[model samples]
Target: MKQNVWLYIGEKIIMFVLSIFILSLIVFYMARLAPGDPLVSYYGDRAEKMSTEEKARTMERLGLDQPIYKQYGIWFKNALQGEFGLSYKYKEDVIQVINKRAENTIWLGGVSFLLIFLFALVLGSFCALRENTILDQIICKLGTISSCIPPFWMALLLILIFSVNLGFFPSSGAYDIGKANSFKSRVSHLILPLTVMVVSHVWYYAYMIRNKCLEEIRQDYILLAKAKGLYVHEIMWKYCLKNIMPTYISAMAISVPHILGGTYIIEMVFSYPGLGTLSFESAKYHDYNLLMILCLITGIIVISCNTLGQIINERIDPRIQVSEVSRYGK
Candidate 1:
């Protein structure tokens, strides 16, 4: 047990380091191709009129005049010591800005994700159990239709319906200016975007869980339990649901990454104080430091979730081997 724990920790460290290295390489390589000199992208039209000496001085300041790979080597070395250079827009240590925004994004994600998970599980079960009935057909259609809509467009529709037409919630933003720090105020502010969050996630989770539950219900064990005089509800709740919970968990693991990614759109539309909004603004302004950081974070979330999902899958279904022998050979 101790050895397995140690191995798991070591594996996690290696995964984290590998993720950082690959992301750093991609970011550095992409930064090198920012259309023009770093100094030039920052300066715009002023870049064209600069003297060769002036350009050389500016390039030297950004370390842009050096060979691309050499510059990346230095950057990576400094990054190991916790330096991400500087932000082009904020003109501050990029780490501080990233840390703050990361917290906000994480908070929003946690709340929204939890709410969506519970909501999806319940609603999905309802729809799935009612399969072939009119209610099921209607909800199934709705889920399919809702899943097709882009998250951003859905945000807009939500704003129009709830804030403009209904006048029940704030149009955009996360909190009231006066009571920004109050929990009550934050909850009120959260309702609109959270509504969007639920809308975006529910359909997919419901459909996946519903299908998984349905499949489990048809299994031999479930049939045997039913034959042993178990109530339909008992078979569903105790037998089928518990049996398929691992798959439900895997589906959730798949969905969390998507939840993080979805915030990029919903957060932007509402101008919510979250990391997704930060990413959107950075991309628009060509703020490569911020953009790359957020993108890397996004990738980390995705990879970590999938890896953890595999671990959970292994735990629940030991027979479901992860690796398989290749059928094709020379």
Candidate 2:
């Protein structure tokens, strides 16, 4: 059993490394091959003013004159040495640019993630407890409609209503010009983006939770509990809801990427100055080094979360581990 556990760990590590390598290779090649003058990203308008010979020297200096494979080779070599190079557009270390923006993304994404799950649990339980009643039907419909609306559209709508017309909130940015340290300013800026993020994703998870609760309620043990004179709310709260906690946890783990993606979109729409906005700027300007690091960071997060979700699922239901072991002869 211990040997199998070790084997599984080794397999996951190997897969993670391979996934990162492949992701890097794809992004590197695609970025380089894409039609753009990266020199423009680095040198700005001076790139156009340079003569042919000067342009050649500039490209050579930036290592853009090399073959695509050679460029990737150098990048990979430097990356392994913990030197990811500088952002062409920002003229700063790629890591520094990311560091400056990462905190905002973390704060926004983290808060939204917690709120999504919290609301999902409450709304899901509410609907399940009231199953098929008017309240349940209304929540189901509203949730479905909200989930169907595109996050970008929802963000724009909120900005129009709350920011433009009513002048209730700041339209864009993480904080006011001089209020970076002000909690009130930060919260006001966050309201619209957070609303979009939570509304866009909460329903999907809530629907799943609702379905899981209903399934649990229909089980024989729940029937037995009912015969024992337990009230409906008592059975749901103590037994049905408790039984689905593991599944709820697994769902949360699997939803990290989903929520992160929504956060990115919301950031872009709101000009929130997070990694999402940085990612867009980097790609648009052909900031190869910055783009590579951003893609790798996101890829690592997404793959790690998915692997973690699998691990949690297997741990919660050992039959999953047993089945995999038998299938793979490990």
Candidate 3:
């Protein structure tokens, strides 16, 4: 058992490292190969005015004159030493640029994440408990429609309704300028984006939960519990809901990237200052260093969350762990 545990940890570590490495290679090569003047991002209008000789000297100074492979090698070395290089667009260290905006993304994404799962669990269980009822059907239909709508479109519609028409919420940004520390200002600004985030994703997960709960309700143990005179609500709350928690947790972990992507899209539409907006600007301007770090950060989060979900699933269901061990002959 100990050996299996260690083996599992080792495998996950290797997989995580290899995934990041491959991701780095892909982003590095693709960004360099993409058509753009990265120098323009760094030097602005001055880049276009520079003579060929001056441009060559500038490229050499920035090490862009090197072959792609050599540039990657140098980047990988510096990355190992925690130097991710400067953002060509921001004219600052990539980490520093990210740090300034990371908080907004984290707040938006984290709040939405928690709300999504929280509401998913409640709505899912509610629908499961009242399956085939009028309320359940209505919820199902509404959820399906909402989930089908594109997040960006939903964001715009919400902004139009709540921000433009009613004048109830701020349409863009994480907070009023200079109100970063003000909670009320933050929440007010968050309303439109959060509404879009929640509306767009809540039902999908809720539907999954509803199905899982219904499946649990039909199980032999549930039948036996029903025979023992347990109420439907009692059985659902105590058994069906409990049984599906591990699966729900796994789904939450897997949905990080999905939710993160949505958050990014919403940020862009709303002019929110977050990694998503930064990512767009970096890619648009061909800020290679900034784009690379953003991609790496996103990739790491996605891969780590997926791995964590798998580990949690295996832990909760020992049969899965045993099967993995046997499959690997560990």
Candidate 4:
């Protein structure tokens, strides 16, 4: 068993490296193939006046004149040494740019994730227990409806209601510029964005969990437990949840990067100062270095989450085979 586990780890490392290599290549080519050049964004209004010779020199200086394969090699080599290159738009190191913006995202995304997960688990279980009842049917219908709504639209609606009409929350920005950055004010700014994230995603997760719980409740062990005089809620908490946890962890981990992707729109709509908003700006300006680094970091997050998910799955349910976990690639 130990040997099998070690073998799985080796395979995982190889897979992760290969995945990163492929993803990086795709990101590199796609960014280059896009319509505008970084110089346009960098030079802004002055770009059109630059002569052909001047543009060539600028491209050469930025190494954009290099062959595609050569550019990839140079980028890969520099990346290993922890150099992600300078951002054309920011005129700063890519790592520094990312560092400056990551904290706000962590705070916003973390709180939203916790709330969604907690509500999904509790409410989903309740709905599953009362299957066929009016409450279960209503929740199921709502889940289906909510899943169809775009997150950005929900964000806009929240801004319209709470921020524009009621004046209960700030419509945009991470914090007030004039205030002393009190927790109360910061949280006030967070409310609309957080609500958009949680509300948009919660019902979908609950729907999925409800189905999983319903399936688990039909298993023989649950019936046996009930026959042994175990209460429905007790069997659910002690046995059913234990069986359900592996799936929940796997789903959550795999969705982390996607959730971050969703945050891009929400953050942009709210003008929140986070990685998502930063990425949005970078894309608009063709900040190649910054955009590529953002993609790389997101890919790494996905790979790391899948690895953690597999490990946690094995710990949660020892009966889960290594073969089963190995199939769950990010």
- RMSD per prediction, one decimal? 4.0, 1.3, 1.4, 3.4
* Residue 70 Cα positional deviation in candidate 1, in Å, after optimal superposition: 2.1
Q: Whose TM-score is greatest here?
A: 2
The sequence of per-residue lDDT tens digits that candidate 2 reaches over residues 1-330 is 787778888999999999999999999999998998988999899888989999998889889899999999999999999999989999999999999999899989999999999999999988999999999999999999999999999999999999999999998999999888898989999999999999999999999999999999999999998999999999988998898999899999899999989889999999999999999999999999999999999999999999999998988897997897796576
Better of 2 and 4 by TM-score: 2
Tens-place lDDT per residue, model 1, 16-98, is 77987888788768766756445544676788899999999887987778887898888778867877777666676767778
Worst 10 residues of 2 by lDDT: 321-330
- Candidate 1 runs further than 4 Å off: 1-16, 36-55, 322-330
Q: Which stretches of candidate 3 lie over 4 Å from their true place?
A: 317-319, 328-330
TM-score of 4: 0.89
* lDDT of candidate 2 at residue 83, scale 0 to 100: 98
- Please, what is the TM-score per model? 0.85, 0.97, 0.96, 0.89
Q: Count the backbone clashes (under 3 Å) in each candidate.
A: 0, 0, 0, 0
